[model samples]
Target: MSVKLLVTTVLLLLPYVHTFSVEKRVSKLLSWSKSENEAPTILGWCEERRLQDATELQVTVSCGDSEPLEVSIPIPTDENTLARTLWPSSLAAAILLRLPASEQLVKDRHILELGCGLGLAGIVTSSSAKSCCLTDHDEEIIQLLKNQNIPNIDVSYLEWRDEDRPNDIPPSDLVIGADIAYYFYLLRPLIDTTKAMLRPDNSAFMVVGQANRESQWDLYHNVRDGCYNQLTDEREAPWNGETRMLLYQLQMFKWQVDDDIALENQELDGTIPIAVMIHTSPGLENFAFTTFDHIATKNDKEGIMMSF
Candidate 1:
């Protein structure tokens, strides 16, 4: 056969060989309703790439209890390495589908993802936005991102606590990350980078669970008080099963929250509960949110002066 055929044949055999070493499917339900005594659990498993037999990668995620919500994310099968994360960060996938479709995502929007271990959040975001760039300290993850074609992704090496800014990534309208608060040391510079990239007209957002929200909030608030923002709104919605990831349109000026708020968890009955947040200035001024039970974006007065 020709060189092309030989390469094709080799590629096809790789994922299967890699997949065989691990359990084919990961089955477990993880819970997000956590507290001080409980940290969310991660269940690891491997998913075979459809085209490559020897190249299937390992995926690990936290499965929530409720009909055992288990979904496998793409992983790298080479090097005989290990995989680790809180959940496969399906949050971006959850947030992406939640955004308003009429408000088309900007194609030229500069997007960045922190702790982009497997590049799932960045890759999935590119499917909705203009372009996405990913950063991580590990050279291994950078190499892994290079090997994968996740729609529109630009990869660069970065260390969170490092003094210098990441050269490989450029300034952007939005800086995207999922589950960055899992480590306390990474909070400051990560938020610092997001603030540096924040635009006056367009806002930014980071998708994280309640588990990591407090840490991110603290770091964000330290910078400009109300200049940084957070949004959490949840409701039942429909998806075409493109993947339960999420994306949003937001500016950071008019965000609101209160103590003793009622909280809810994922609904695993084959439909995803969606939260659409816009890191926008003044929360879209009487904005009408069409998807979440036809609820309007409720405004709050807690933001500092000139926050919007």
Candidate 2:
């Protein structure tokens, strides 16, 4: 064959070779796990997605239930763009589904998923949580999430860029996100939003793939500094091939709920009764009475009640 012919042929076959290599890697990585009868299982299937060099992976993820949840996830063609849904979300979904039966945190607890692209993880979480909300900053994504008929899951807009707590959505017992820490600018906003959305005493858990990326590390340090306690796990993933990821579980040191309650108290008028109750030792009764009198006098309140 002519050198020109050989070069052209090789060039033309490049895409095919790349595709085959990716497919082989994916197949190896996605090999079936032990059945749920014995342990947690994340059973999955894949199909080529139209108009993109990507695949749609569907998984029957089990969480100690007789029937596993069927979740559809679209892998991104380009990892650089935030417009495409990424694989970390799918991994996070699987992790949420595979929570052990002993850990009943999801049952009867309100959950929130932040940066919930396509609502994959959030939707899966809805099965276990009392109520699950799928939230993102983009309107188009929110609209796409709303089109799906997921039971016990609601779609809402939550802009991390906004410094204040988003209105209307109730506080959640657990907050979650997947592949959300890809940019430097979003670091603080993401943490702040998590703080606002969670109920008192609970922390947020976030899963991020492509752990080697510099951007992800920057976000991790920021989170470590900002959060009271942060824990991380690393594992292999099969989305784009055998990729490693870091799962971060962050706990806020102090509940913002206390601050909210203080604000609410400040807003309240003194029309309601203000009570001072103290069970004192017999010898300290006079001192307790004096303290109550001082408090009542300072407040100038008529409805102050004292209990022994």
Candidate 3:
């Protein structure tokens, strides 16, 4: 929610004034086929530059369905984009690709997605589940999420770190999310809200990509111990023909007390490991909390769901 209030006041300077799904904006950027029955698209538009070199990435998300959809965006070679693409955000694409698939575990359930970059998973949940809410701090994106939703997909401006409740994710019986653990400041508030919003009878399903193993583990440890039942789900693999990195290694001690973890000084806080604090409640048996080590292996078609 760093983009909180800051972007609201500078609304006139922002390039993207309206709010909508990343897929919808990316579709406008790339002009992909708007089919009636396409899976929710994750990547809509992205421009970037690292170490002085410009980079442009566009992806069409066929999430849950995992069909590689084509995306179109200008090559970073464009002279006009040199300045704007310096630090463009890619969280929208990540949110879309990280949404979970439908199964007996999570159908017709109330779900909530945080840091909904472009409302990818939220829109999909709105379409598939009983109901869904998409939240983000930026008004522009929230505006877009609202515009894209025809009759469903509740989009709102919510800062997970804020003590104030924003009114959308409140009735969330179950929580769902991907790629939400990026910074330390954002992480604590997210967990706090999750605790406040989640119904006692519900569980949360979160997807962590193969990119950041250590960070995911830190996040896992922060919530697993007493607050949840750290179950050992069979390992899962990654898509895009890559190995699912042993991502949750640090979180292995999540079920136990993490006395070994130490906090770093302010200068290098991002690199230091963090311990998770889990607080248990009275109705423990009624709900189950755990992490699934999903080692997803893929070929040409059909995604993974290893167990029978």
Candidate 4:
């Protein structure tokens, strides 16, 4: 078969092969949404020379009543190792889809996704967030991100291990990652990076996921000991039928809390009910839900923030 025909065939068959993988569907949804826009975005090595199985990916994100945003990303045709591939692991897909699916959590928020392998999470959230940045330590990954013509997102290189942080990257309201806690040594750098990029105010939240590995559990303790407060913890089965994956929503804070505000405000009378929070935005008069609950008490100028 001709190289063009072979590459086309592989692209077509890829959906069927990875149908159960949510990331594949997210990519397809991105591609489809892009095609629906003013112009269809191009991806992959479109040079005269085509590599076999050099695939392109798409990611789609939607907010309430808004047109879904789509991004077309190219996958490197050279790398064949397990470490480098465009395919999204189960944890990655979960983290990408976790917040974007909720209009209240993502809409109008400035988002950043670190160690974005294929940038699936950032791309998926770009449509909903006011702004988004997708970054990775790998030079090749940054090149791949540059190739994707995603609207309303800044694609850049951000190394977590760098002692001097890059000045170009802006602070974000939310930070996200997937399967980032692969090794024990990466724990500190990832935590530091998360802290550096966040807004430092109580409003910012970080959502990350990891495969159910015993070693990765150390990350939980490290985060708690650090400046973050753990919010929601949930588990799900992977697409490939592997062990359950853990998803965590952690709240970032600049100031240390002397007391457990969440524990104390659990039953405050003046607090608004949960029904109001699902529709309200933070920093507004209406109640908004964070990793914790908020309660207004007498003589308190600001409502107390509580973590779930």
Off by over 4 Å in 1: 1-88, 91-107, 149-151, 211-213, 216-278, 281-290, 293-308
Q: Any idea what lDDT model 2 has?
A: 0.46
TM-score quality measure for candidate 3: 0.46
Model 3 bad stretches (over 4 Å) = 1-101, 207-213, 226-308
lDDT of 2 by residue, 52-130 (tens): 2545534444433345556655544445546354353344344434455313446667878888776666766676678
Q: Which candidate is the best by TM-score?
A: 4
- State, as a TM-score between 0 and 1, how close model 1 is to the true structure: 0.51
**Could you give the C-alpha RMSD of every candidate to the true structure, in order shown?**
15.2, 22.9, 18.5, 18.2
Arranged by lDDT with the best first, the candidates are 4, 2, 1, 3
- Taking the tens digit of each residue's C-alpha lDDT, what string does model 4 give over 37-83? 53322111100111235467443443324454455666765575332
lDDT of each: 0.43, 0.46, 0.40, 0.47
Q: CA lDDT of 201 in candidate 4?
A: 44
Which lDDT tens digits does candidate 1 get at residues 41-114? 32211121222343334432222231212223445544444223323334433333233431333355667777
Q: Please give the lDDT score at residue 95 for candidate 2.
A: 41
TM-score for candidate 2? 0.51
- For candidate 3, the per-residue lDDT at 113 reads 72
TM-score of 4: 0.52
